[model samples]
Target: MKATPADQQELLRLQSIDTRLQQLAHKLGALPQTAPLAELAQRETAVRGTRAEAIGALEDARSELTRLESDVAVVEARIARDTDRLQHTSSVKDVQALEAELASLAKRRSDLEDQELVVMERVEDAEVVVSSIDLQRAAIESEVAELEAERDAAAGGIGVEREQTERDREVVAAGVPAELLAFYEQRRARGAGVGAALLRQRTCGGCTMTLTGSDLEQVRRSAPDDVVQCPECDRILVRTDESGL
Candidate 1:
């Protein structure tokens, strides 16, 4: 807006600071560790572990139930064979032995049936656990999807802001004189903040140090159009009305 060369340079410096501040603010707002996606990933991992344990338990229960059922079948077969032998036996001793064998097989069959029942109950419980874990895993998957969407949105928004900053930088660059722009860029690359500072109350804003009496006098006597640099920080110093010295 028709600013003097010094005022324009100051504006450019201010713009540069504002741009960096905008980027820093965005970065602070969008930290990866604190993002929703990260938390969702952690929850998904826990749910998956639980699901795996539940599945393993179910498989073990099924295996035990199978073994118990096989044992029951074997005992029943032995009881049948002993009953046939008892029917055909001629001696009282042989008959007694067959009866005893049949009784033992019956007891074994009963025991195997009880074990089978217990295994069946455990299988049912494992199935319930697996079902519960599956539901939980599904829920976590939905949350992960939502978090990924949010992360994508945040990234898209940051991209837009970066483009806007680039445009603003171009505008600021155009207003700055070529030689001055080169000088500012060089100093900025060397770690100076914007390569310019405002002089206020006889203090160099770049370094926040007050100038010596003679240097202060010299600055005051210099033409307004002349560009001056802070001795301590080597930054282009713009004189402001608030400079007391």
Candidate 2:
């Protein structure tokens, strides 16, 4: 393939813009927020599980407390009935028996009341745990939202810049010969991000590999309008005044 010296230079400029565009695409795909956002989402799920368990514990504690309260009420009722019996009894033995029964009911009620207090404490503690977990889940969700927004804005800026760069590439690519442009595009389609580069100071800019010995001699002998490719990377080497031919 052959292109004028001016066309070769335009191709290099077009390559530069295309390289920037590729880099922008890479940055957009590998946004920094991606990993952290994923981690935050996992944490949110785990914390929510903890919150669910806490809620279950709270319900269990409340149920126990209710049972204890009912037991205490029954015991107090028995004590009241026994005391009324003692007042109506005429026999000393009956009175003594009624007092003894009242003492046993009082002891039962005291034990039930104590158990109720312990369960109430557990319920309060579980409530605190649930509340703390809820706040944690909310914070993680909020952070995830913020990171997503930041990532989107960054990608949007890259999108605008890439659009502008593409416009410039189109204009520069217009000046290149059609056959040469088609060849360049084919090379790019074959997974070569760079289709062309400048040969400056005997170095291939595409691969940053300096040509030496016979390879250097061949490029040096090639005409200025001649299109050449790098032996290492197969990218077109565009000759320029700075090529040190």
Q: Write the residue-wise lDDT of candidate 1 on 74-163 in tens digits.
A: 888888888888888899999988888888888888888888889899999999998988888888788777766766676776666776
- Which tens-of-lDDT digit does each residue in 1-245 have in candidate 2? 77888887887888888989899888887899978988998898899888889999999998998888888888888888888888899999998898888888888888888888899999899889889998898899899999999998878988889899899988988888899899888766663688888899989888899999999998888887888888888888888778887
lDDT of each: 0.74, 0.86
Return model 1's CA RMSD, one decimal.
9.1
Best by lDDT: 2
Give candidates' CA RMSD values in order: 9.1, 9.0
lDDT of 2 at 180: 86
Per-prediction TM-score to the true structure, in the order listed: 0.53, 0.52
Off by over 4 Å in 1: 1-34, 157-245
> Which residue pairs does candidate 2 place in steric collision?
none
